[model samples]
Target: MTNKQLQVLKQQHALLAQFIIRLSLFYQGYSKAIDEELQTLRGHLGSNANFTLAHVSINKLNALLQEDGGVLRRFKTDTLQSVEGAAKALLATSGKANANTSIIDTISQARRPAESLYDVTQLCVQTITLYSQVTDTLPKPVGVAVKSHSNEPLQAPATLLMALQEELVQLLDTYQKRLPDNTELTILKQKVVEGLNNDELLNVCLTLLRLIVKDSMQEAIISGKVIQSLHHSLSSLHQGLNKSIDQAHCTFAVQQDDNLAMRKELIKLENDVARSDSFSALKTQTQQQLKQVGSALEKREENDRLAQQALSGQLEALKAQVAELESKTRYYRNRLAKQVATSQTDPLTKLPNRQAYNEHLRKLLDNRNINEQSLCLAVVDIDHFKSINDRFGHSAGDKTLQVIGKQLSKALDDNDFIARWGGEEFVLILPGLNAKSLKQKLERLRTRLTELPFKFKQDRLTITASFGGTCFSHGEDPDAVFERADSLLYQAKRAGRNCVVTDKDDV
Candidate 1:
């Protein structure tokens, strides 16, 4: 390949990396919104059952409409109207209720489709735009002879661009077709179409760095803004989700309180009836009154049971939502790692950039809890990293790090996590492990590293890594534990580098 073609390929690779990062971030937001929505739907379903019981009381009140010349008709009508109004109120507050029931069937069903669409769209857009930018930046023809001899075709860039556009168009069309026919869907589709045709299109065009030479950077210039627009659209979804959940919670609480109040009132009414003494020849009337009250109590008890069942179902649904959210979060994390590696990671070694390591450490500290089980942290640093880098250049340095990361990861159990801590440095987290076991594991890992020979450019390079480990031991704070491990790592470095060190006090 000519220098120009190589340059174009590099530019394309960079764009692709950026696209992936943006797509992953967007999907993360979408997933979170869906989770929140699912939780809200569950809450709404619980509230609906509670309100249904209230409607039953209203139905009983409506029965009085048949009383002749009793002025009951108006009261009954008013009660029915109140029930209708309440149903409408419930529907209005729960966004999921507004969706076509046939399409989603349940709140849980509705959430998945919408969330999946969002993620798919984000990913597709990122992929295509990156591809387009890369193609557009192909080095100028140099000379016709050079271009022809280099096996570069004249129409490849245009063909690739058209293919990308077609892909995006198809994705959007498929998404729209899947949405249930509704005003919301219509509005969403219109917004998406407008974004694609206007600012988003312009941004895609500008991203082609070659367009800069033609004074047409409009697409690249607006790409960031288009991304922001997409972000705003997603943000609106979360707001709607939050409102639904809030309303559901409020309705449930109110229904519970009302049920208790009704029970108390029924008891008071029964006591009043029992204490009365004005029924000389009205024994039958008193008996009838007692039967009616008993029936009402029984109905109330049944309603309470139904309401409780609904609430329990809602809680289970919320748990499912939380689980879904966790899964989505995992996906986002993996996507982020891929994106970061493409851009900032040592391509050969596939190790975390310095920035990523710092972020990882912060996350570890933030997520740690006092009551959590024992946590073992190990820091491993290569013994002679600089010598390898000097002898074989940066490429060999990368391969060494990648091999080390792979070995370390393979040596640890599934519960353990290993990440590139920094240049030639690695960190591992082993949960539910005590200090002694952690030490033994580290020693074994060290031994394995000593035994292995890393191959690069037809030469075998032997390497050793020093390990320092400390355990949280049930009650210790994360910061203190990390500090101890770090100090031990320094100790290992001092004690001839290829060894494992633990806190002396613990030993």
Candidate 2:
């Protein structure tokens, strides 16, 4: 053989070796990608129970990759076995068309390794696109369920997968762009594109298979069986891919529904809590109002008790006064019957004359029963009465006496009756009153009278009175009570006017 021819053959062999190496690298890279994807899915499955759809998709992908690998291995073995036949056919071909036909036949019949690799790559691409669309259209169910169950969102996995898919598509695009556009490689590329086409390529593949068996003169053989098997494998891959897509879609839908339901429930719960809060506030307010009402009721009860005590004391005092007045009426009637009739009562002041006061006291002592109630008498005389009469005339003095008389009446109850005993001096009788309350009532009356404003002509005048009181609890004679009260009056006149003094004690 010539050196140039030998060198040409050596160059051809070198090119073939380079093509095989590149194909092997391609296969290795594809396998690694499949392995990595499978590992990622396995990790997800193990770590997350919610990744059921992903687990199933990964299992299907692994199975598809395994089948593809088997197909590729078979193609490699068949191609090696058919290499000598291909070379012999190439040498014996009479025209360029025949040589091309021979090469095409060899490729068609020898189980092309690139075909399975192409299928695997397409599967990977389709799977990634399906997952991406699923994730984009709805949230990842695995991650959503994880977050739902664990109360933690898992955003990293979906983000990483998106980035990886992008990288894979770029890598595939780069590899496709880098491939040499030689005639044989161009034909291979066309075949790949054709294989991706659903109907036309399938018909061409069937025709090629039929022609091969017909040329071999194999009679009564099912030529369609081989096509059917390829169809079955393609169908399996398609179905698996479609199933994975459906699963991803379903998972996404479920997660969306769950999220919506959770949100609705949460909103409802919040509303309920708000309602509860309103109710609680209302209840609290009601309780406060009830407490205020209860407090008001307590205060009312206390006031009622005080009023009841005052009324009871007043009622007892009235009963004693009625009894003493009955006895005094009898004594006065008897004295009037015995004495000469005299209109000695002062009409303006309603006070008894000095003669009448002396006669009444003597009768009271003479008619006194052993069981008769004791008398505590006070003589209240208005101070500076004569000066009042001089300064404001007789009308002013008469008004002053009337005011003092009214004040004295107001100070005494029925139990302690007051009769203007003589002139400005009023006399009082207590049937059963203790001196302390009686004295306090008298002092209050004195204070009220001092505070009163008496109008005389166009002028306002005020007056003060001095009071002398004595209790005759054991004295059988009214004279003794009178004398004691009179002595106290003199002592009050000596000490100071407009003051109350008792003969019994410092009342």
Candidate 3:
């Protein structure tokens, strides 16, 4: 080919390499960002049943993301190789006689890598959808601020915290606030010191309590040990991988030196052939020398090509090894994340715990457009729940709680939010509802609960509840709204239990 055309091909090759490098960088950066977000999300998601659902979803998305990263890397490597191969093949041509076929063949050969790049990009886009599903599967759990999470263990300000605890106990005493019996009170105090510092922490602690009793915590603990072993396994595999790459580089360097020597020998032979006299004056020995040199040159080229193929095979094997290690790493990581998700759900009822309920309530109130969007909050308590627990058994009480939770969920609209708000109390967040409608809905739910022949171990019974609800007013604290509803619930109890009471009540 002409000097101008070869120069143009080299320029194109360089430009292609630069573009491929940039694209690879972009994919890697974007992937890293997605991974970081998922990790942060996992932290916020905490632990629970809903989190289990979310964890599985997160892993699926993460696997897709990891696959996309691998594909993008492969596509970049193949594209650069294709561009280099096409440039070299074109530059090696003796003349322009077969330029069109050469160009067409090169383009045809490169098309697969281009298509691969497109497919990988498409797969990356699908990851965005998987990510959205992950968000939907659980949503950010209530009250737990993952933003405050730290690798460092929390060191509660001991002296100050103690004084604060004493002050709180005294304050409760001054108000004549009722508390559990001394044995239960001691347990509660220990829980406080062991750091149920706030309502949210108590919710998380209680949620985990159910899991521990049911031995899910034992399984998670075993899983934790397995994670450690897997971590070691990944580290060992990574070490082996680095060794393989280093050894391959050593072999490649030696091959490169040998190839350089062969090139020098071929160049010297070409110069000797060129210096030969005119055809009529050419000697027989000279012709023999030229023939031998040409054969030797062809053999050297073949050797160089074989070396490259060997090196390529080694590099591909290394890539596969790295990918496998990463897959295992992600697997272990996701399993651990599942445990974290486990902590965020109520163990017995498998509902979002109180912390999650609080967040849901806050979100409803915060997202409300005061003029257009009305919201309602309700607190439902099973009437005489203690009497049932005392008469039947704690197991029966648990069964009752579980049954009521499920019944409440099934009875509510798909858009309505419900959660176990500690004990036999259920909290509801209903958006786009006025006080009248909200009361009606709660009454319907209460009626459904009444009809439920709650069965535990072949013993069937019916139970009822009292509900107090209020409309969410703009510029009001969500806590105040709930307090008002709770007060109305107390009023309902005074009027006689198993009733729905709302602000509309003239009482």
Candidate 4:
């Protein structure tokens, strides 16, 4: 190796060391033993140790990362979830007189510890920023958000319960097609229509997801069976074709032999006539030769007839096989189409899902006329949704989402689009709307939600959402526009939820 090569290698080693140090810092709280191993590996890398010796430590570190990468990823996800939950809890308590300061301080101090982990730093920063925003908006000192427990019947949110009832009924209808005699699911479906509590709603949601998965798997299995049957039929056809070819060859060979025999007899008869001493001898020889020729001709015809019949039978069988395969192929195609539709829809709201939104956005961005069109994107978040879940239950919260989603969707124009953006949020894609018009449209939708007559366990409730909207600039990235819209939405939240904020100068 050259001197320059050795220097380059050392630089690469240094880079690797820096990366390992970052990982060690990021994954600090996973395990003490793992931490010790990381420290030892750092020492080996930091020192001017032999290259091969350092490689041993490098290999060990690599093994640890590969083996526990999933665990680390899950830890990061859990932490992010915690941060988000805490932020939401704090936001829900903002402006309330009973909100506790000690809990707020604990949450603040707990998250203040430097989390140098990869993307966690951003999440932590966002949480603190949310805290600041909440504090800035408070009219008084914050206090506890939770209310004391009450002994009231926990009726599931009305809309959510109805949706579940409909889903259950639909499920039972589907089940009946397969087994009409089974009444268990039918009974359950009827029971759902009567009423359910939060726990029951949770179970129903879980069961719905499970049944959906099972149905998907069932479709896959049917597709597999169709494919397998098609394959078997094709294999049979191939073998039949091979047999037909062999039979045709054999029939050709036999015909050839019979023609040769007839020719020899004719030649022999001619020679015998030429060498005959009398007409009587010639006539007898001619008779024998003619008879032999007739027999050979009849034998050839019989062999040809049987070979044709066999080939015709094989052809018919192959035709049937091909037809069966085509039918199965059509069945599989339909199943696949259904699966695609299912994948792009959200089960809860019956709206297009995030995957669908992404696809739609991609197509729009790829269009030539996209820049010429006036496109507006807005994010809507239900205000203090977590509190609804805490007080009424998740079922009520879900119903609230459903009702709001339908209201917003109903309020949109023909050119507008809406999708559930996961967890009490919905995104709208409104084309041909400027900032002013978009703001008006969002306000209308917000007002409509407030009018919804929501009741949980005889407690009439008012629901509201915050809106953040932005108009697309010429050739702007969708993500950037979405982030801007999201920021505006948070601004609406800080402005005391249930209002619209847009990136318009006049507004």
TM-scores across all candidates? 0.34, 0.30, 0.48, 0.53
Full-model lDDT for every candidate? 0.54, 0.53, 0.61, 0.70
Q: Predict model 2's lDDT versus the native.
A: 0.53
Q: In candidate 2, what are the lDDT values of residues 1-507, reduced to their tens digit?
A: 999999998777556545533544454554555656655554544423335655575576655464455445543443332332323223222235544444434433332234543553443344334333333444345643333356443342323332222222222222233333434334433453322332433343344334433322221122234335446555655565565566556655655654565566556555555666577765665565456556655655665566556556655655555555556557656655543223334455654433455566555545445546555677777887757755776457656777788777776675446565433567766556567865776688779889987777787777888888877666545555665776687677778787888864653
Instruction: Compose the digit string of candidate 1's lDDT tens values, residues 1-507.
Output: 999999998777556545534544453442343334333333333423333443454343333222221222222332232222222222222234223232122212211222333443443343344333443455546554444346544343333333333333322333234334534434543443333543444454343222222222232234335445546645654665665576568657766765676676567656756876766534655566567667766776776687667656666655666665566557656865654554334333455443454456456545665335556788898997767866776457656777888888788897676766444677787877776888789999999998887877788867999999987654555456655776798789878788999874332
lDDT of residue 159 for candidate 4: 42
| Candidate 1: segments with Cα more than 4 A from true spot | 1-348, 351-371, 456-459, 473-479, 505-507
Write down the lDDT that model 1 would get. 0.54
The prediction achieving the highest TM-score against the true structure is: 4
Superposed Cα RMSD, model 4: 13.4
Give candidate 3's TM-score.
Answer: 0.48
Q: Write the per-residue lDDT of candidate 4 for residues 1-507, one digit (tens) a residue.
A: 999999999888788877877877776776665677777766776656455755787687665555455455434543543454454456445664434443343344333333446557666675666555555445432693422364754343344344444445434444444445756555555566556766775676466445544544455456556657878878887887888789889988988898899899889988998999989988998899899999988988998899899889888887887787788779878877776676677766778866678788777767626458778899999998867876887568768878888888888888788998666779999888888899888889988899989999999989989999998888887767876887798799889999999987323
Count of clashing residue pairs in every prediction: 6, 0, 12, 7
Local accuracy of candidate 3 as per-residue lDDT tens digits, 297-416 = 686677667767776776787677677767877887897676545544666677776557766766666667544588888989899876675677656776888899999998888878
Question: Which one wins by lDDT: 1 or 4?
Answer: 4
The 10-residue segment of model 2 with minimum total lDDT is 165-174
Error (Å) of candidate 3 at residue 114 is 54
